[model samples]
Target: MTALAGDRLPPPLAEGDRLTVDDLALRVRVSGRRKRFALTVETDAGLTLHAPEGRPAAEAEEFVRAHRAWLVAKRGLRERTRPLNPTKRLVEGEVFRYLGRTYRLALVADPPAGGKVNLIAGRLVMDREQAGSPAGGRAALVDWYCRAGRAWAGRRLQPWAARMAVPEPDLEVRDLGRRWGTYRPGDGDSSVGRMSLGWPLFQLPMHLVDYVVAHELAHTRVLGHGADFWRLLRSALPEYEERRSELDELGRRMWMGEMS
Candidate 1:
């Protein structure tokens, strides 16, 4: 990218080329539909400048320079919210979370008669046999999360769907690796969509969980995270940006089946 003259624009960037903005390295993404430059700060604090196709590199540089203050502030926030993917041990007093609340792990001699694990007296109780084996304990805990997450998400779906004015899709909680949630629209013989939320998402606070629910609901009407999709989401969750930021901060710390 180079300084421009008269209506001329720099040659389009190559596949792996980077956009250089003084002191800041930015990835350039040219979107034909975008009317103005858009700057994105990712969860990892990576920078991307989304520009309308054929915009001069100098113009993009000026835009980034003008918004340097905002980028700096957002980078600071991202730095403060760095990833903390902590591993867990099945020993007593090991912490677990359910809907943003913490509960300690407790070992018991006998299995609770009905299940591999149980929330007894605000502690996650597992029989000695299960807790003694990390693999067994982890499987039992994830099963609990899947069951609990499905039940809770089931009850909350109708209300959020109503608020978003979209039909509630069939909800399933499972291990959707690297994604908090996903919506699969119906096809072929099925007319109803199915929304799959990761079981680990159940460990976040209710508000953050709701954020993901509403987010997928928005997809019920709009598929991509384009302007229209965000606009629809904003209409339903006015404070979605804040919720998303909080989710980015705390979600990385949630236990994702890692055991020690």
Candidate 2:
């Protein structure tokens, strides 16, 4: 199941039992007070529901039946937005994007004595290139991407934070799969003041990357995305709605395989 942001839980339900509006294929949850019934619908496109607790099941079912067409359309839209998974694994000859352009992975090995990987010319030349051994080559490439991402994220965020009236946020670049970035509120004297930026090697644009930075920075003042949290964010980024969609689309393509 997907997540609902900012204190938006399915309208208060009873014992958490669910009923599927068979006519609409929409899922309804009965919860909160025994008398109160909540509705939750699942569609990949997004969530849409009309919840009225303390209503009879027959009444709730009728409401869902009336919206059957809308529910179907919503599910179809969500399915289209799901992340794409390629059948082929990442390897040589595979195309990957960086800085708005695409590059093909090429393996080459010619070392003086020790192994090293460097971006020579336009290709990723590996000093330990063994056709059967892709581990070393992959490590070199991932390291390169991490370095590039850290520099790119810092440069883009520094100026934006300053202009928005937020304090300078320290940067920590690391590989985080579950989350993209986070803001850490400083404790007392010795605590470090900073933000943690996660750089997964993918082709997301600079504006979308900055959105995450701005999102965390706003947390410094308004810990949650209540109405005030959104207002604070809009003050810095007026077009956040568009940016959020872009990130969701691009963030899905990022690969996170461990290098051996």
**Candidate 1 at 192: error in angstroms?**
0.5
| Candidate 2 global lDDT | 0.62
Estimate the lDDT of model 1.
0.88
Shift of residue 181 alpha carbon in model 2, Å: 1.6
lDDT values for all models? 0.88, 0.62
The alpha-carbon deviation from the true structure for residue 172 of candidate 1, after best TM-score superposition, in angstroms, is 0.8
All candidates: CA RMSD in angstroms?
Answer: 9.0, 10.5
Clashes of each: 0, 6
Tell me the lDDT of model 1 at 95: 93
Query: Across residues 18-107, which tens digit of lDDT does each residue of candidate 2 receive?
Result: 545674443444434445333343434544344446455566667667767766776777676665533223356665556556666565
Clashing pairs in 1: none
Which model scores highest in lDDT? 1
Q: Which candidate tops TM-score?
A: 1
lDDT: worst 10-residue window of model 1: 8-17
- Candidate 2: how large is its RMSD? 10.5
Per-residue C-alpha lDDT of model 1 across residues 1-260, encoded as one tens digit per residue: 54566755557543335888879999888877889988989888898888887766788889999999999899888878867788999898999999999999888897678789888889988887898789988989998899888999898899999988999898999999868999999886549899999999999999999999999999989998999999999999999999999998888888888887
